[model samples]
Target: MAEKELLRISNLVASFSINGGYYAAVDGVSLQINENEVFAIVGESGCGKSALALSILNLHNKANTKIEGSIYFKGRDILSLGLEELNKIRGRDIGMIFQDPLTALNPLMIIGAQIEESLFYHTGMNIGERKKRSLELLTQVGIQSPELTYHQFPHELSGGMRQRAMIAIALSCKPSLVIADEPTTALDVTIQAQILDLLRRLQKEMKSGIILITHDLGVVAEMADRVAVMYAGQIVETADVNEIFSNPLHPYTKSLFASMPDAYRNARKDQRLPVIEGMVPSLLNMERRGCRFAPRIPWISDAAHEAVPQYHEVKPGHLVLCSCYKNFYLKSIPRRVSSSTLR
Candidate 1:
């Protein structure tokens, strides 16, 4: 049986103006997150992963950012909502676990108050009840000594503990959809595992859909049910997590796998970890037409690329954006070849 859809984003384009003209950070992206599943978006630093996540709730500054298309959450178009209406949905309906705990959490406010802030705005609980709920939330997120942790300020907690506190706050309202953006970014390997585990367990308990935005494919492998690979402000491929790992089709996806350290265990001891050549193009400089990845893949003929490429399913439930992936090769040119040569 198919699970109920929780959120549906259609032809969403989030654009920000450069010096004068605007460029898309999320260009005509469409996706859906089912109830009780994790939909992970993975890409390199400048590939607009974070932009897509923030755009879901219309969180960008309207003064400069121009958002087009619809973001329908539970059948209502979130893009059309006013601030008062959107405020109600931000925490209670859709919670966001921001990447930086230090910046997201208030230094002056006690951790308990921070959690209670969401409760105060969203729920009609009394002060005593709110405090009790806050304590329970801290405990639920795996923080030991919830009472003590509640009284401490955000500055007092360790990096891992602070991140846990952030999780506690996001889940305090028991939102239907949780957007965890790079939740394990700066943490050590051990803490990263713990954080991911906690998110999985909490999602199962709360029965919430999750939009996990991160560059770490390892984390995606551990937690995501499905994955979206983004590059140059557009999603290049999307598939079931197992299928993405086992049978990736996009050239960008293939290049990313080659660059991972764990995928090259059998290589020569002196061989360096592979790298995807060419810096991500500036948003202002991105081509207005054709495949966004065309510049990086020079070996493939121009005819291989569609004038306006769009995702087509290559396997069941797996979509690749470009036809040029048909005969792609990572080693078409020698190692250390320059981007100029590729062009």
Candidate 2:
């Protein structure tokens, strides 16, 4: 049987205009999220991961922004929807949990009231019913003393609690798709683990698709069913989480994994931590002719920089956007040294 696609984005292009020239921030990105699966977009900061998420929800600032391409949700092109229709779908069908809970939540409003507001707007519920639903949501997200927590203002809650409240509000409408942008950014390590666990549990129970946008490979390994590595506004590689971690094909993907602290520290003392030399090229100065990563490829020649390599399937479900892998063979990348080397 065919898996159901909850969200499908194709050739999405998002740009910011500065000094009369438009610079593409998210260019030609395409990916799909299946129902009941967690799809993650992983990249370093400013790699257009957040921009891609915002474009999916049509939440970008339009005065200085230009967005093009299709974002389809349940067969409807969300980009084509009217403002009124889009607004209705934003929370009711597509919930969003931003990176900072403090900024995402209203300072003056009580957390419970905020969650209740979504229920009131999306469902035909009275104040009492909304309150009941709000408390239920609070408890569902693992907040103890839901009644008390609901009445507290955003400033009254701790970072982790505030984040939990934000999750409650986002899930209030029982959205079929949740877009969590750096969901664990401000959290402590323990709290981060808890939040990721909660999200994983809720996603499984609700059978909803989740788009997790973060640079944290650990988090991706913990929660993602599939992973997309974004660089310079394009999805350079995508594969099942296991495949991505075990057999990354793209040089950029390999570089990212090699740079992970745990992976790097465990490497042999004689071996240098694999670093992709050169900073990400400025999007404004991006050349349309060759691979965006060509400038950073350590072993490739000038001839390889002449054109953008076509995305090729290197495994059953894995796709890499570079031809270098054909020459490097997936298994030839140096293996990580034993954990004993770290100590």
Candidate 3:
């Protein structure tokens, strides 16, 4: 049976004003997350991944940012909510694990106080209850000596511990939908794995839907149930995790896989890992129509691309944007290359 839908975003466009004109950073994006599901948004640095996440919570500066379209969480339109109404949902119903804990957490606030802050606003627990809950959360997130860590400020904790504390605060309210934006960014590999494992175990325990925003395909492979590949401020491909790994359709998606170090093996010692040519277009300079990925893969003929691209589901439950994917092939790798060959 299909899992219950937890959140839905439709035709969402998040644009920023620069020099009197608004340029879209997340354009015409739509997707849903189900209860207990991990929906990953993967892309390069400037592909609007974080912009989309911030839009969900209406966290951008309204004076300079323009957000259109509906963000429905449990059937209520988040865009339609006022500041007070939205505040009620922010920590209690929808938690966010920000990319950088050092910047996200309060420098002067003790670790325990930060976690208690969410509970204080969302729950009616008193000081004693709040402290107990805070310590429990810190311990839950794998921080040893929760009692001692509780009194320490953000600067005193190690990077991994700070990140764990961030997790504790996000999960303090046991929110129904958690948006973890680059939750493991800047952490060492060992700590990154531990954080990922903690998130997985906690999600299973809470049965909360997760929107994992990251560029790491490895993290997506390990944690996501469904994956969306974004490029040039739009989602170019989406599919089941297994399907995305087994059959990546979009040129951008294929290029991402090809760029991974593990994708190449038994190669000539001199052969370099393939790099996706060109950069993600700047927001103001982005092509508003046609195949957005065309400029990057110049070898593919324009005839293969749709003049006005739309999602084409080449397989059940797998959608690839633009018809160009049909004709896409790496100049280095031959056509009909199997997943094994790439891996």
Candidate 4:
């Protein structure tokens, strides 16, 4: 069975002006999310994951930030739409779960008012109805004492409670697609599990497509239906969640798996935990040739890297960037790993 396509992005480039010159934060990226599925974008800290999420809704400052390319949601090119038109869809059709609840939520505003703002703006709900819906939303997101929570300010809540409040606000209008940018970031292990489980349950209940952005492969393994691995500003690999865990093709992807903690490791044990050598290259003044991950993979021959790396689909629904996979080895060791040995 095939899932319905909810959102599609193509050649999307989001650039910020620095020293009167523009640098691509998200460069030539393309991906899609489908209904009733969780599609995750995983990468290191500086890999433009959040930029890609924000670019989908044109959420950048017009003064310094420029976005180009098409974002098609529900068969419409939302990128070309005006602010008035986009506003109608922003909270009504699509919801965004920001990374930091403290910063995202207003300090002066009460929780119920924040949730009701979307309803007030997008729906034709009266004041009485809005308050009732807001209380129900708080309860649905696992918050105890809905009435008390509604009147409380963001400062009065714990980190986990604040996150649940953010979730409540996001799902207030039952959006068709939800973009959760590191929804569980800063919470304890127990709270993280609870939040992820809550998200999964709400997604199923609302039947919404989810684009979960995070650096946690463990979370991806537990929640994602498909995953796209980003390096620098480009997608280095993408595949079904099981395919990624079972047989990681891209060297960057393999390195990420190798560096996982014991709890996230998949039977690949060793005396020392693996770490990918070298740091991620600066996004500014990027190398205009070869693989973006080539600097960190000096052991692999230059011949294995393409001048302009492109995704090559070697299997059904599996795409790997460039030929760097051929000569990929760990921790400065030079070994040609054949696809047969990949198993």
Candidate 5:
């Protein structure tokens, strides 16, 4: 059975102006999110994960940000909509749970009022009804004392509690789509698990599509239905969650798995955790042609890469960006792996 498509982003380019020049942070990327599915985008920092999320909501500052893309949400082009027009959909039909609760939440307002703001704007609910719904949302997200938490300001809550409040706000309208950008970044392990569980439960209940942006593959394995491995503003690999875990085709994707401490412990305790050499290129310096990951994996021959890399479908629903993945092997690691054994 086919899942219902909720959002479709086509040739999305989110660029930032630097020194009078615009540099594409999210360059020519496209993907789809379906109803009742969690689509995870995983990559290291500065790989344009957040940029893509911001572009979805048109949240970037227009003065310095150049976004050329069609973000079709429920058949409407979000990029083409004006601020007022976008506002009608921002928190009503689509919601966002931002990374840092401290920064994302308005400190001045109490939690309940913050959630109510969405209800006020989107739903024709009175003050009494909004308050009632706010408390319900707070309780639904696992706040122990909904009444007390409701009146308390964002500064008064713990990191986990603040994150819960953010979740409440995001789900207040029962949106069909939610963009959760690093929802568990600063939390501890136990709290992270709890948060993930809460999100999973809520998503199941709502049956909404989610764009979960994070660098943690562990979170992806646990929560994602589909996964996209991003590298320097482009998707290098994408597949069903099982396929990504079992057979990560892109060299960058394999390198990410190899870097995980658990992968080393599971394979051989003596083996050092493999690290991808070199940082993601600065936006201004990022190569716009060929395989963006080639420089980081210099052992692969130039002939292995396409001048302008395009997606190669290795199997149905599994896509790898370039031919370089076929010949990729970490020079530092003693073992050389074929495509089948890359993971």
Candidate 6:
């Protein structure tokens, strides 16, 4: 049987006006997240991953930007909702934990008060009940001494603690869907692992779907059931996490894995970490036709630049945007080549 989709985004096009012309930051991106699944969006900087997230929540000011396509949540089209409808959904139905905890939290507000505020606005709970629930949420997220941490301001709490508080706030209303955008980016490795574990636990307990946006493949590998790799404002590849790691088909996907710090370090003794050759092209110059990555493909001919390749299934349930390049590149070239061999 087919799994039910909790969220479905199709042909999403978003743009920002810069200088004198418009730039498409998210171009015709489409994907779906099933209930009780962790879907990840991975890409380098300026790949429209963040833009896609913002579009789903209707966070971008519509007056200044143009957006098209559908974002359906729970059978309703979110893009078609009015301000009041969206307000009712945001935080209550779909919660978000942004990248920076300090900035996301109010410095003057107590952590407990911050979480309670959501209840105050969204629920009819009195102050005492709100506080009790807030503490429970804080404890649920693994904060030690919830009472003590509750009284602390954002500054008094450590980075990881603040992040936990942020998570507690997002989960205050028991939202059905959570969008965590690089929630662990600023934390240490140990804290990152803890936060990921907390999210997994919460997802399982609440049966909520998650959209996890991050550039870290390691995080995706650990947390995501399904993965979408974005480049130049488009999804270049998407598959199950195991399929992505074992058989990444897009050149950009392959390059991203090759550029990982661990992979690069292991591949060479003293060279700088492997890097994709070209900078992401300016969105202002983005073309509606053709693959946006063709310019950066190492040796592909100009003909490859003429059109965007239709997404192809290399295997059951594993979809890639470009032609299969692993056989052409991986098998033809030795895994380890000496400098003399290149010459």
Which one is best on lDDT? 3
lDDT of 1: 0.91
lDDT of 1 by residue, 143-180 (tens): 99999999999989999999999999999899999999
Quantify all predictions' global Cα lDDT against the true fold. Answer: 0.91, 0.87, 0.92, 0.90, 0.92, 0.87
- Candidate 1 similarity to native, TM-score: 0.95
TM-score of each candidate structure, all chains considered together: 0.95, 0.92, 0.95, 0.94, 0.95, 0.91
Q: Give the clash count for model 3.
A: 0
- Cα error of candidate 6 at position 87, Å: 0.7
Clashing pairs in 6: 290-308
Q: Which regions of candidate 2 are displaced past 4 Å?
A: 263-267, 328-343
Instruction: Give the higher-lDDT candidate: 4 or 5.
Output: 5
Q: Model 5, 1-343: lDDT tens per residue?
A: 6888899999999999999999999998999888999999999999999999999989999999999978898888888898999999999898999999999999999988999999999999999999999999999999999999999999999999999999999999999999999999999989999999999999999999899999988899999999999989999999999999999889999988978877434566566678888789998898888999888888888999998898999998899998888888765665556688767
Better of 1 and 3 by lDDT: 3
Ten-residue stretch with the least lDDT total in model 6: 326-335
Ranking by lDDT: 3, 5, 1, 4, 2, 6
The alpha-carbon root-mean-square deviation between model 5 and the true structure, to one decimal in Å, is 5.1
Q: On a 0 to 100 scale, what is the lDDT of residue 141 in model 5?
A: 93
Candidate 2: RMSD over Cα atoms? 4.8
Residue 197 accuracy (lDDT) in model 3: 98
lDDT of 4 at 63: 96
Candidate 4 lDDT by residue in tens digits, 1-343: 6878999999999999998999898888999889988999999998999999988888888899989989999999999999999999998898999989999999999999999999999999999999999999998999989999999999999999999999998899999999999999888999999999999999999999999999988889889999999988899999999999999999999999887776533655444666777787776867746798898877788998988888899798999999889778777333447688886
CA RMSD of each candidate after superposition = 3.3, 4.8, 5.1, 5.7, 5.1, 3.7
Ten consecutive residues with minimal summed lDDT in candidate 3? Answer: 262-271
Candidate 1: give the clashing pairs: none
lDDT by residue for model 2 (85-142), tens: 9989988999999999999999999998899888887899998899889889999999
lDDT, residue 42, model 4: 99
Tell me the tens digit of each residue's lDDT in model 3 across 1-343: 6789999999999999999999999999999889999999999999999999999999999999999989999999989999999999999999999999999999988988999999999999999999999989988998879999999999998889999999999999999999999999879989999999999999999999999999888899899999999998899999999999999989999989878876434664756667777788999899898999999889999999999998998887799999999888886644445788775
